[model samples]
Target chain A: MNSLKQMLPEVAPPSREALLEGRGRLVAEARDEAASAGRSRLLKRRINPWTALTAGLVAGTLGVGAALAVQIGGDHRPPERVRLVSAAEVLSRASAVAGADGAARHGRYFHYRWQEISLPDEKSRHVLGSGESWVPAGGNGRGLQRMQPCTEGNAPDCDVVLNYKDGATDREGFTGPRSPKYLRDLATDPDALLARIRRTAKGDGTADDRAWREITDLITESVGTEPKLRAALFAAAAKIPGVVADMNTKDAIGRPGIAISRPGRSPQQIIFDRGYRLIGDRTLAVGKGGPEPGTVLSAYVLVNEDVVDRLPAPRPGLVR
Target chain B: MTLPPALEVRDDANELDMISHVNEQVATDDEIVTWSLRDPEVFATLYDRHAPAIHRYIARRLGPDLADDLMAETFLLAFRQRARYDTARTDARPWLYGIATNLIGRHRRAEGRFWRAIARSGTDAATESLAERAADRVSAQMSLPALTAALARLSKSQRDVLLLTAEAGLSPVEIADALGVPKGTVHSRLGRARRKMREALGGIDPLDPREDAIDE
Candidate 1:
């Protein structure tokens, strides 16, 4: 460190003359570029003055006509506009609802759907869809929707079904009939889950599959309801180096939502509604060993308000 | 309140005018950017304002040659992107540093190699080589390699905060803005980096009370 400090003395400050010279040169270059671009624009206008004059005249005429119309307007009063309530106000309202147990249970969940609309040259629009579903708390939650079948050229049919299980535990457990059919079914039994994941992952003999298995194991090892554990999971995820969480604010349906993006590789978006309630999440895996060409990964939706009355009592467990 | 006629008619008028002229010339950085957009020559004023400190920072990190290139690149990139520049930020140093950081990222491998070479050489090339200066140089050199090696081991974010605060002379908030991170994150990373550096430097912690007293 002393040696490094010694080196520090030799680190002379930059020469004032050289810096000034560089600054002058940069200024000169920028001025030249701007001047050239300006000259080009002037030349173009000079070559076609008629078009410019016509456009200017039309614009001037429109301005005068609009001004006169406004002066002689039938209704000078501005239209009544609805003011947008701030996020803070919405959160305060949600907090108040949470404070009242009855109001909390009466909460309804509104789902906001979005799709990517592609354009030419790799540009795409993240367009919000008109389709929405309202799931009410303490209701029999079941719905049927058209889904893609396994057969090719199959028409949209009522193939997909959504069922809301009341009085269900939020804990990680297999949904549907309780049977150890696949690897996920044994997740509740930690030892069995670990053994099966390891065995099956080894047999799979693919790097991507192994990575998934390892991630699953890590998640299982770090799973729990404890806030400390959740924070630990976030920290651990950050340690993976390339993974970054993109947090942005957006309106999910009518409710304020946060869109947390995992971009590029296995891009995913997790939307959290106002009051930090989990709303819906979608992921698109587009690289090697993940999903067929243009195949989106399975999406999950959780409407907190709809499941408020049905959510089982909290189970105590250490996160990690 | 009226001045004496003689005094009022004296060189004070010229002096006051000069002061106001200087003030107008050395306006806020945001004002400079807006002026630069209209007249590119205005950017030279900003380069004059910030280049000394920025040059010194680059010099300390990568030595003179690389520092020159980095400094030039930083200003050039800033000039090219001037159209998209946010005029709201009065202080342009953070924006300049952000550009510098991106340039530094590209040369990360070279940086690691430079540090390793310094560690192996037992003394940085910038250190004094005079016989009379040998004792101090040796002492400094002995610990420097270890320090550089340790610095090389730190995470990019940790290194960024440490270097920005210590060498670039930026405040924590400035560092946060440069890195596009929360201020709390900057503070924590600085603390962690300092601790790690101390630990790596055989427990001669810069923030420790005994060391602080010694420096004082």
Candidate 2:
């Protein structure tokens, strides 16, 4: 049984002549796009507003988990920026505070409460979802997760709870949302931690984006309990290429914070409070297709985190 | 402080090094795309980086004769549509492959003919390259006809997913991104396509899991 990749006949790469010709065509296209800047603006004006909005909404739905979004319109304007802080400075400050902020506390479970916004393509309405989870701190006991999706007028009927009887253990090399055992096993040195993240991260996008996503996932799930790990994670994130910080952004819940963003169309921005605590993260739609350049396609805010002895039952009136 | 010729050459080398270092500040694909907004010539960097692979992909599908123009067309279309590129994707391979695949879609009959020609005659434009793989060539010789017939029979979408996996070496996720389809669709289509290929090849499995994992 031959692999398709092997069975397929091998073809030569483009010849030098072909390469030059293709490059020439690309250059020509680029010049034309630049030359027609005015025409593009007029074309943009001619685009139906309703059609553009529909495209954006459709893109938003696809953008939810896949991180792939649409860009519409022709305005090639980059987003405005005032670089008040560098990403290194922000991460350094966060790392400094992380290790000293709180004393070590013992508890049976680590509890986290967060709110996430998702856009289901068909409905095209923002679905606000909340989740609460309690993982056994020792990594060998029952774990509970309660999730609910709510909208403006409809709520209270969709609460769902999941239980992991043998503790919530992440896959051995998984980088996203890990358990205490996984966090403890991670390298504390910044360079090594980043290498490990690169090795294990399974997300889409560039390598740097995947590394940053893994660090953010750790911050969201386990870092609140392990201050030392949180510091290391922040340090690791500071090393990702093309990371920049803006001191004027706000999280999903309107809390002002500094944002560290990767370079991309709808780049994910991680928000940190002035005191250097991770508050939330959001994806900004900066390119043409979907929403306006500054629209937040999806976002998550950490409301509370603590070490609890017992997993509290779902909030009164919220879950049956 | 006049020095020997060797020292002067070293000084000149240092000056050149400094200039090249300044020029070599690498930029991500997204950054290049953004910069191309102001200086369109910057778009040529993307072509230099990806044109060979894109050209080869087109050649394998539609034969080397049309690869020259289609590859240029692919980049031209991408350049025109640069504004719509989801900047969120830092690596432009999927997006470029998508554009190339769309362009390839237009020459569907040409591609079918390409496969049929291979099925009819075991030799292909790539046979010269395949000559090195003597062992694989034996099996490929036996399977090429059946494989081409299977590929010709598959639906456009299924073949797209399968070839993106087999030829472009794109992961399932990347295929989804390139085609603007769901990841699940890539998975299902690839499964069906491979199963058909296996049946066509008398259950030899054109793609053996042990060789390479498709889900990756």
Candidate 3:
């Protein structure tokens, strides 16, 4: 028990002087608050006839937590807990899952759809809802989006993000960091493929880090994806020293999965299910300017991805 | 007195190395709080007495970046709320822990992030392990990656109970007061937490009698 307790990393306490300064700050703030309230007393006295109503309003407004409390709530279903296993062990299992789930996916156009959640402010997060894109398998496509309802406060043309129609002449070739043609022709051997990626990757981080990010991004898109390449990608990822395994994680919808992520203040992550199939991606950011830490800066959970001869009509409830 | 080997710093085996000692123990924290109501300056004695441990506990929960700020806040809040101190309870650590725990809860998301990050990075190493054998090593130590992951996976309430008890050395009663939950609830949470953690340890409970036998 002591051994397990010992595992936690200790933070050194604030200096003695810092604590005293904090006390001083709190006292000063309190004095300022009291002084401000002194002026407000005249305003309150004028409104004294309605003081009861005012007090009730204040209490009601502040009782959000009380309002949210559901009395008698009992746990009906406990979440499925993962058995304690070594991170190395979980990663190895996840690698196997990824390898088995990998299959070459091919189609004329790469259509990807996902739900994204973002924090608009510290108070609450907003789900931007499902977003879909169809890129030419060769990396060119024109959008012909159907209009969707705009959010209540949004302008009538708020659906502009969705509603669009373009001529077939309007197109773009995949000019991504790795060219579409180059990606397709890349070797499948984990070593050879990683070497190719390292050679092509140009960035501030080390070649290994750049290679890791490129692989993660490429796998995120299933366009022209192949299972063999996906499996090899996992193998190649395992070779990168930065990528590690975490089973104590959940996808956007609360399904538990293992994750591989980078270290630092804000990290990008890829989540894989117990079966090792890619499930989602999430970015974590420490809330700047406030107490919010581990803010879900953005996240996307994969609904499903498959190649189709043609893009299907928006399905029921997909937009919601 | 046997102290819990908490958040063991690999290089800093000596806790004394981190915090300067005043080498004087006088009034209990509850007494200090009581006296602080009349004279707030006396509260500094309580902070001096307990801030290091509280800071360490907070740091273990939320990491060092937030620890200093949160630790200072905990003491300041203690100073402000000294009037409400329950004199029946002679120890103030539990109450201070309660305050620190609330602060740590604000960073709950970061805790999960750290767990996942540690697991994925595969290097929550304890620097140099103290175990006689690699297999005998305490998984709770940072050297073991999945343990923190397991901790992160615990239901937030359960994690609170486990951490408050294990890290802060608060008795179950103190935890109940600290968390505003019933004693029974604290016990149940601790039970559930340990059970889940035991499973994470491959059915080996660190506190189990069997583990003690292994050490023997």
Candidate 4:
């Protein structure tokens, strides 16, 4: 068996330059941790309210700038022209696109990948993270979720395994009893779906707010799966009171898109590309006891997705 | 034993440097991991000591290009999971190898492609120099495809156990600790892997296969 070690060609250890480059990542993490610690100290004490507000603005500006840099560096495509349109118009466009997309959704597994940036609170470091999942389409079966904390310089395929099991749908953000199959079974009529979403949507805020949240959740989940369901979800969202569309908006990843949002302190906005494709979503920190107004508290951009015939290995007997 | 004035000064500086180096060297990996919880910066010491070996191991498994990214990822992941690391085990090599192995598992397709490419072409991205490839191919031409084909045939678990033993040079017990599998599972997997390799190599024992094809 000793010969097996030598079966492969001799490989040089990483060059000094490569080693340093890799080490730089660890060093940056350390630096971020230290900054997070400092932020924690700042949050714990009572300071002059005006000074606190000023510090928040400065920190928020710097954090948003760094995030924007990451987005710009990763995506080089010219910005799409964003036109301020009525909420009804944006939803209509999205509905038409979804209806016209005749691609059949018939695969054993649905794989979703997205990049997320979140500033959990005032103290914690704003983290850029990404996640991916491979789930069985219809029923309870084996699934895998991979997540990783990413840096501006490097965002590789996730290494952190968040879940691997029969009911990974719950972890994939399809709240209680909501799986891909469940979404597929939902009403396709816009009004009927809106009624069902209002009933199913739970948690804080008014009925419209909760329903809006549910609509976005379904939109994110069913984007690559059920086109008819997606069309209904968008059209349903359009009916929510105070829903508005910002013509000029860019996702956390700096992809220009039309942002459809409802007025709220922490408003969740979904950004769509020119073709009305769901590109990304973000929650803004507006008004008061958080980061400065217009700061994105959390955001995620869809990286890629596919209907894989079979998930990658980890299947015991299914090797090549 | 008299030294020149410049040499004496350099010797004095080296002696002073050794004192600080010795202080750092005294802290075990466990201690550093614990210290890093508070300081965070101390985690770099672990990266400095172990990353080269980890990087090379990955390079062997999945060519050099991917190895760089995965190697960096392994340490970052280790740092993130350091709090959960069982410090009872003083040596972090098994733990680090375990992380590296998991990352390699994700790239199973790329690895399969790498092996299949070699089986078909007798060379891959890792086959560095033309002269080395030419010389190695002469002796290995008959067995190269067989070896690679055999590797591609092994189940992911069997391959992980086998490579942890052969590539990272971990004992079965350490392999168990690294993989979170029982020692019995490791032995059986290793046995099965060796048996597959033997059958592929014209009934020659993989436990003691001929060295004709091996360069190192």
Candidate 4 residue pairs in backbone clash: A1-B207
Model 4 segments more than 4 A misplaced = A41-320, B1-25, B130-142, B207-216
Cα RMSD to the true fold for all candidates: 23.8, 24.0, 21.5, 24.0
The residue-by-residue lDDT of candidate 1 on A1-320, one tens digit each, is 22223323345555434564566568678779768878987888786578656755775777765554443232323112211121222222222222222322344332222232221211223332222223333322442222222121343221223344441222232122221123223434333443444455453434434433343233322211222222322222222322322112332222334333323433344444533334555444546675442233433443232322232222232100
Summarize candidate 2's per-residue lDDT along A1-320 as a digit string, tens digits. 23766666677656556666777777677767667886786787788577667766876777652332312323343223322235776787677557644434445676778888653332353647786767655445455556664332266443333343233433232123455556666746888889988998886777777887777777666533567777888888888876776544556565656677664522566778755678777766656677554455677887777777786665666542
Interface RMSD of each: 23.2, 17.5, 23.5, 23.5
Question: Which residues of candidate 2, in runs, are more than 4 Å off?
Answer: A35-320, B1-25, B130-141, B212-216
The most accurate candidate by DockQ is 2
Deviation in Å, model 4, residue B190 alpha carbon = 0.6
List clashing residue pairs in candidate 2: A71-A288, A71-A289, A72-A288, A72-A289, A264-B87, A265-B87, A265-B88
Q: Cα miss at A28, model 3 (Å)?
A: 7.6
TM-score of chain B of each: 0.76, 0.82, 0.77, 0.80
Instruction: State the lDDT of candidate 3 residue by residue for B64-91, as single tens digits.
Output: 5667688888877777777777788878
- Output the worst ten-in-a-row residue range by lDDT, candidate 3 chain A: A159-168
All candidates: DockQ: 0.08, 0.13, 0.07, 0.10
The local lDDT score (0 to 100) that residue B17 gets in candidate 1 is 15
Model 2 RMSD in angstroms: 24.0
Residue B173, candidate 4: Cα error in Å is 1.3
Per-residue accuracy of model 4 over A91-182 as CA lDDT, tens digit each: 87677567655545444676788877775654443547666667665434555655564232244433322232333343433333455556
Candidate that beats the other on TM-score, 2 or 3, i.e. the better one: 2
Query: What TM-score quantifies how close candidate 4 is to the native fold?
Result: 0.43
